[model samples]
Each structure stands twice: as C-alpha cells, then as structure tokens.
Target: MNIEVSTLAHSMLADLHNNNNNYGKAIPGHIPRVPPNIRNINRAAYDPKVLSIGPYHHGKPGLQAMEDHKKRYLREFLTYMPGELEKLEKLNSLIYSVRTLEEKLLSLYNQPLNIERDDFIKMIVLDGCFILRLLIKIRVRLESEADAIFEVVPLLRRDLLLLENQLPFFILEKLYELIPKPNSIQPFPTLKEMAFAYLTMKLSTDPIALNNLEAYHLLHFYDLILLPKPRDHLIFESNQNAPSTVPQASKQEEPGIKITAKKADNFLEVPFVEGKLQISCLEIKDVAIPIFRNLIAFEQCCPTAGNHLTDTRFMDLMV
Candidate 1:
C-alpha cells in the first residue's frame, strides 16, 4: 500500500510540473465565486434570482422559465443575420462558430466547468444572443414592445447586472458582429451605449462618457463608470489643518465659506475645489451596495482586473 501511494504521488507531481510548464504564463479566464466567508455576508447579491446568463447557473430549477424566452430572442436575432440562409442553417453556423471558440472561451474562466461541451456551446450562444437583443431594445426605447417577462425592464436589467449571471464581453461582441446593421442612414448605437442606457435608466444625466470599451464583462464596464480615477494633484499639501466636519447647507450660506460644483471630465471624476465645500455629481441608489460588493468580489478573484482594491478601499474611507 505504501509503495502504491508513493507511485501515485510521484505521477501527480510530474503532471503538475508539465502543466505548469505549458500554462504558467496564461492569465486567469474567469473570476472565481465569492469566497465562502465573504459570501456569507450577502449571498443573494452574488446569486441570480430571475435568470441565468452563463454556465455558472445554467440549468438551475427556478431559472428554467427564461429558457424559452431566450430561444425566442435567439430566433428573432437570427432573422436579422446578413445572409438569406434558413433559420436552422444560421443557427447551425452560429453554434459551429461558438464551438470553434470553445477552448479559447474555457481559458477565460478561473475554474473548469463540469458541463458537457455541446451544452456549454449552446449556453454561450443563447446567452450572447439574448444580451444583444436586450441591448437593441434599449437602444430603440422598445420596452413597451417587450413580452410578458420583460414588461418589468428593471427586473431584467437587474438580472443582467448580477455578477454570476454574466457571459464574457467577447462572446456578445462576436454575436453582434454576425448581425446586419440597420439600413437607415442614421448611425446605430454601439453595444456599449445600449448597455450604459440600461444601467443608467433611472438617471437624468447623459451616459456618453464611457468611451473606454475594454471591459471583461458588463459589471466591469459599470464599475469603470462608477469609480473615479485617482487624482494625486487634487489632494492638498496641508490636509492636517483642514476641518473634518462638513458644514450644513444653511450654515454654508454665510460669507465665510463658498459652495461650488467642480467641472470634471466625467461625472464620477468630479471633486471639491480648494475655496469651499464641493458637491460631486454622485448617484447612489439602493442597488449601489450589492453592485459594488459583487464588483469587489470580481476584482479580488481576478488580479488582471485593474486595481479595484485601491478604489474600494478609498470608498471605505469615505464611509
């Protein structure tokens, strides 16, 4: 028994060394599930309640209702494909394209999925097509035309924003590339614009500032718009002498302190100036905490995602 155990250990160590030599330099593909201890704080925020977007929660019991809706959306989407091929032909072509990308897509996640290869490809196609349709609907203000499930656009939007309920951005982009553009002379909105429209549906401010489109997923893009880039020059040299307590609005009306809003390149970047109190154009709704919590989880799991740690820590200080 001892000799058999020793042989197995030696074989496992050899395999580990071989794998490391082949893939040690590769970047992690998928953000990990939230650590158990941290997830205990608010597990619901990390899990999807309405619909599943990717392989993570693909065939869960409660989310089965949306499966038919996703098929309907995919069918509608294929009708808009550039060629005149039959729907089955187009569908088969799409599945083949995604299948070709199977290995590459698998490399994007941190953990290996236990689903079958065909099931994984189907999930990617269905989720990617569903997202494209939703984005197009938002672009044209077609919520009124939505079916029963999407009548509550807010709920669908919330489901899409959940961390585990996400497909990589590239999958959506590839599917988008397959669709034919509108024949109208007017320019069509990009996927990012449509996403920003859905995310900031309740806000009155313009959503045109998200120019950098290099995001891993929708949640990452939302984080890019929500957090401000650091500005070292804005910090005062003599901060030790500054007052910690903020004055009330009525008290600041006197001549001693001046109140003004800073002009910033983007809404998130707005900061207070030196003369008096500065009110930034921040929009914090009830959904803010859970959204940030899941985004922080993503950053923690994937180090390749930029320094969200520093940004989250700074927000903690403000609190």
Candidate 2:
C-alpha cells in the first residue's frame, strides 16, 4: 500500500510538470467574436452573407458556395508567375513562409481553432490569395463582364467588410508580395492602393489619401476611412464645450436651426457652425444597413478602435 501511494504521488507530480511545460506563452488575440449581448441583438448584421474571408465563418453552409470561387481565384493568382515551374516554386515558397508564421497567426484569433494545423494553413493561404486576387482584378478591371462573382460584387463587398470575416492584413500583404506583378508597361498600383480603390469604387467623393495608414484587417481599413482628418481635430476640439446632447431631429424643427447636406470626402463628418448643421451627403441603400451595423459592432467589440462611427453623431443622422 505504501509503495502504491508513493508511485501515485510521483505520477501526479509528473503530470503537473508536463502540463506546466505545455502551457506556452500566451499571446493576445486581435480578432474577437462579437459578444453575446451585442450579437444577440442583430445576428445577421455581424454574420457574413455570401463569402467568408477567415477561419471564424469559413465553412458555414451559406458561405460554402463561394469556396469554389476562392479556389478559382487561387488558380488565377498562381498564373501571374510566368512558367508552370516558376508557379510551383513560388507556391512552395509561400507555403514554407506561411508555415513559419503558424504560431503568430494562431495568436491573432480569440479562440483556439478546432482545425488541424495543415488545414488551418491551407485555409489561410487560400483565403489570403483570394483576397489579393480579387482586389487586383477589381483594380485592373480584369474580371470578365459575365463573371458570376462580379455579378454579386455588392454582396461580396458586404461580406468582405464584416467584422468577423477578416483575415489579418499582414497575411494579405505577404501573399501580395509573393505574387508577381502582371507584365505591363505602366506601373502596377500597390496593394494599399488597390484595396482603397476597391473599397471606394462607388463613392461619389474621393477618399482621403491613405498615405501612412496601417490597418489590422479589411474592416479596420474601412473604419480608418471614416476617421476625421487632422484639420477636423481642431473643429472637434472647439465643439468640446458644445451641448452634451444633440437635439432630436423632430426637436430641431424649432426656428433658427437649419440642417443641410454638404459634399465632403468622408461621410462621417458632421460639423455645426453658426446655427447651421452640415452633414456629409451619404446615399443610403439596403446594403448600407449591415455595413453600418458591422462597423458599429467592430467599434463595440474592440475598445482600442475609437468610436469613429458613434462619436461623430453619424448614427443619429443615419437613423
């Protein structure tokens, strides 16, 4: 009995030691799921409709239709390399380089994925390449007029901008660097330029120049576009002493208050000067609902992401 007890104690000690060693250094997860309190309110807004860009919603039944498109884009992207041999070599190199980022990549998500290591890496590569290719095609107008994907470009745009459907910008940047630029006498636009162009394709006003912006993901990139410019900082500061609450639209019907829509580069700008309130003109459509919800959800989920959506009194105007 004494020997058996001693052996049992020794086994427990060994197990504890193994568990301690297994606990690798903890890294912060940049990608977080919307909390139940917020997600329960409007689940559809936070969910991807057509395509899933990252692991969180990668294999959903509804999003599966786009999986074939992703593969097709990957194949098209590979063809950017001149010869078959060069394509094979570049792909192999990409895989090897991505493998080295396994731990770092895993750390970016809020939870441990149930996917196997190989499967996770494959998903990353496929999704990253698909995004880069899509952006490239959109920038160069290389997509066929009858392309099914292009037919639903608006839906694709919504899905790509969802808070949950995001691949890290670093992964996309890496894939863009690996893929050879198309052979053209004119210089190809940088990846940042391509992304900006794609995002602002339908905007009437020109977007602010993204000179030194660094985005964590596509949603973050979009959020950055709505941020007030440096000059607007002074304007915001001056309004710090303004009323704590904005008058409701119905209440603003009182005389001497005039509200007007002004043409501006960004829709988030709302400036009140000399009894007049000026808001940037925004054409709201059915698609704008989910996009706004997702942007607000992102702001709520990530505290570090400033309240660009909510703080500007833009939501009041939209409502």
Candidate 3:
C-alpha cells in the first residue's frame, strides 16, 4: 500500500511539472484587456461610448447602433475597389484574404475569443472597411450635410481612441493594400499618409514622424502621436538624487517658478529653462480628459511601451 501511494505521488508531481513546462512555452498576446481593478476605477475612460472596433467590446449594448453603420460603410468601401467584379465577388475575395490571417490576428489579443471563425473574419472585414471609408471621407471632404456620422464625429473620434477599441494596424494596412485607388491627377496617398492626416486633423497638435514606427493598433498610434520627437541636443539632464515624487503645480508657485504658455510644435514640449516653466499652448476641450485618461491607462497596462505620458518628468510639468 505504501509503495502504491509513493508512486501515485510521484506521478502527480511529474504531471504538474509537465503542465508548467507547457504553459511556459506559450507566448503571451500583445493586446491585453485592461485589468478589472483599473477598468473599475473609470469605466468610461476604457469603455467605448459609441463604437466598438475590436472583439473586446464588439457587440456591447450601447455600441450596437454603430453596427448598422459599419455594414453600410463596408458596402460603400467596396465601391472604391479597383476590380470590375461585382460587390459580392470583391467581398468574398477580401474575406478569403482576411481568413488566411486568422491565426495571426487571433494571436494579437491577450484572451482567447469565443467567436466563430466565420464571424471573426466578418468582424475584421467590417471594422477594417469602416475605418478605411472614414479615412477616405476625411481625406476628400466628401461627406453630405445629412450624414449622421459627421454630426457625431467627436464621439466617434473618442471611441476610436479608447484602449479597448482597436483593430490591429496590420489589418487596416492589408485591407488598404487590397483596394487600389482609381487613376487621378494627384498621386494616391499611402495608408500611413491617410492615417496621419486623420490623426492630425483634430487629435494631434502637430504632425509626428511615422517613417519607421510600427503601430500595434489605433490607440497605440495615438500614443505614438503624443510622444515628443527626439531633439539633436539634450534639453537638460536631471540630478541623480532628485526626489521621486512629482510636485503639484500649486507647489511650484511657492518656489517663485512662473508657468507660462509658449507656442511650440507639439503639446508634449514642456521645457524648464532658468526656473521658468514654459509649457506649450494646449486647448483643454471635453475630449481632452478622456484622451489623457486612456493614454495614461495604456501606459500603465503596457509597461514595455514605455511611460512617455505617465513618467514623473511629464507629470511634474503637467501637474
């Protein structure tokens, strides 16, 4: 009896070791669901109010209204394709391409999705086409006054910036490559150019250098926009023994530090020269709060991305 018990114990230990080894071999997904602790604090910042781009919040209650619009955009988007084939044929071809990318696409999200393979492919097609159509509309300025989307453009932009609401940037790039533009007098813009124009229209203070940046998704693209461009020379190096805590803005006044707004290329440039805090002029609109909140949340969740916004230097200056 004693021998049998010892053998069973050894077998259980071996099974546990094998399970751990298998788990360790698995690679983690890049795009993660914001932790419940973080999401619960300010659900509005992480959650989409109008539209849902990715599988995370795809079919939520309040966001359902935009699903019909996505379908309409997908149909409209097909019209811009170069093929002489019917819309159904074009759609099937697009779906086939996307279906081939299923494994890669599924690997991006941190959690395993319960969606069917066909439904997942359709979601990617619909969402990717919707984004492409919106970018085109913004590029051409060809929207009718009766367009409902234009009326709620602010809300739509906000929804696009949410961390939970993003399709992998490659998906958009692939779809863009598949659809060729018609011959025109002016050269056709690349997907990056269109995205840059859309981002700069209202989101960014100035155009960011996107020459070699690999954006994971739309939110990641926005985070990239907020990053300060590298300068040839250093502004100033910090003392090695400086206090870790970022002082409040009010506390700076006590030390005779004068804060003034200066016109600069981007909002992220806040320089301190000779005790004067020169901050770039920033317009604090309703959209600003949610944008910053989501950005901060992103930095907190994705540590490897680096803390450009939430870093102590930036926080001290902003506060």
Candidate 4:
C-alpha cells in the first residue's frame, strides 16, 4: 500500500500519523474506517469463492466437494448407513417404498382414498406417515417447490383418516368434513350409532332420536304387522276396510294410535299372547305370529307394555 500522500490528501493527514517510530509515512486513503450500514457489493467480487460458490465457503466448494458433502449429510441422516453407497442404497429403498405404496393405492382406488372402513384405516395411516416423510425430504432438497410428493399430505381424505381414533372415527369424520355439507352422506353404518357416540360424549344438546317419531324420521326396521285372528282382524282392519262399516276411530282411539307421550316407553302397544303388544294389530300377524309367540315364550308370563325393556345401560344393541 502506498504511504506517500497525493497533493490532494496531504492536508487531510492528521497529527496522529506522527506515531514517531516508523517512517514519517502519512497514512494514505487506507486508514481503516467503520463500515457504513450498507456494505459495498464491488468489494465482495475479490472474494476467493466468488467465481463458483459466490464468496461463501459452500459456494466455492467444487462439484466433488458438493458431492462429498451430500454423501456425508445423507450418511449422517440415514444414521444406520456406514458410507456413501450404503446411504444412497437406504435413500433409494425409502423413496421406492413411498412411491410404490402411493402408486398402488392410487391405482387400486382409481382416485384418492376416502378411508372409511377398517380395511382402509391401515393404508391411510401409512399414507399419512409417507406424506410427512415427503415433506421432510422436500425441506432437505432446498428446492422449495410445491409439486413434490407432499401434495398428498394436506388432502382432506387422508387428513381426516389420520385424525380418527382407534375406532376409525377420525377416518369417517375427516371424510364428512371434507365433503360438501349439503351432499354429505354418513360413511358409517348407522346415524343412530353416530348419534349415540355423540350423545355418549355429551357432544350435542339434542337427545335420543327414534324411528317414526313424528318429530324425526330416521330409517329403521319399521314395525310391520299381519292381521291375526278373524275376530281381531274384523275389529281393526275389517271395519276400517269398508268405508262405512269402519267406524271412524273414535277420538278416544286417536290418542292411543297417535301417541302424544313425551317418553317412548309410553307408546301404545296392542296386547297379544302375553302382555306383548304388536304395534296395535287387532290380530296376530300371520307372518309375525311366530315372533309374537316367541316373545311370549321368552317373557315367561304375558309380556305386556309394562314388561318392556328400557335401560340406558344398553350399548351397541344392534337389533
């Protein structure tokens, strides 16, 4: 560095330059100064790595060094790999497994999976894990693009299935959540079961719902009856059959047929063999005769409306 000052700089040289020990060399324009907030870009060009790595160590590292670094990173991340080849082998295997499973699933389903049944649960869980892994791989690639494998992760079907509990409710709920509300269908066996689950958990304020309950029309095995004895049949259906002979059910009969009770246990039941009622059939339905007889036999004595089964303790009562 030149110490002798130009005529232009001679005046600006300070007395401090007279340190006295060295030559009377007034510092040239080289005196160190505090860097301004913004730095000079031109100065970075002289950096050794600027040609390749852009002045950063990693930037200057040649292709070989980059490959070596990648190998080391893979080895360390693979954890079980002994060297670069082993790491590459592990990566290949992992990538292949994900791709193979994804391909098979998409192929079999002909579309994305809506994992509702127990059969689909396992596959959905595996898919979720695979997506998470893909997200991690994307991060490692540093190529921050969205088209990579993770496109499946946030998809509604897998996400919902993943949220399900051991019961696979997560699987069903997710499906419902994703489906447009107006067109959503119950993916589970029965809405009653779903309602029961919600009721059990105290999830919703609405209470028990029943079939043909006037207020709510739920699908159920509707009670059917066949006219039994001629006398009983004449009493109920016969009179009603003839437009005239059928005395309009007196207002009195209306209350019984049209239940106005608050609780279900109070619904009118026509007495049969035992106290068991057949939804008000005058005669034991020929078809349902055995059912009525069986009920009578099972209940021991006459099974009346009073002998009805009512227990909140009942759970999973499929019938």
Per TM-score, the best of the predicted structures is 2
Which window of 10 residues has the lowest lDDT sum in candidate 2?
20-29
Please identify which of the two predictions, 1 or 2, would achieve the higher lDDT against the true structure.
2
Query: Which residue pairs show collisions in model 3?
Result: none
- Overlapping backbone residue pairs in candidate 3 total 0
Task: Tell me, by lDDT, which candidate is best.
Answer: 2
lDDT of 2: 0.76
Better of 2 and 3 by lDDT: 2
Each prediction's TM-score against the native? 0.75, 0.81, 0.79, 0.17
- Stretches off by above 4 angstroms in model 2 are 1-29, 143-145, 202-209, 232-243, 249-257, 281-283, 311-319
Error in Å for residue 252 of model 4: 31
Higher TM-score: candidate 3 or 4?
3
Candidate 4 per-residue C-alpha lDDT over 221-257 given as tens digits, one digit per residue, 9 for 90 to 100: 1111111213544255643554322223343355454
Which lDDT value does model 1 have at 269? Answer: 61
Measured with C-alpha atoms, the lDDT of residue 24 in candidate 3 is 18
Error of 2 at 102 (Å): 1.7
Ranking by lDDT: 2, 3, 1, 4
Q: TM-score-based ranking, best first?
A: 2, 3, 1, 4
lDDT of each: 0.69, 0.76, 0.74, 0.28
Candidate 3 lDDT over 1-319, as tens digits, reads: 6999999999999887654422112232356676677678777777778888879887789889999999987767666665657666778878988999899888777544678888899999999988888887777655555567887778888888887777888888888877545555266666666777776685323333564567877777778866777774444355545565656778887989978879975778777778888888777687767877777777777765678776646554546
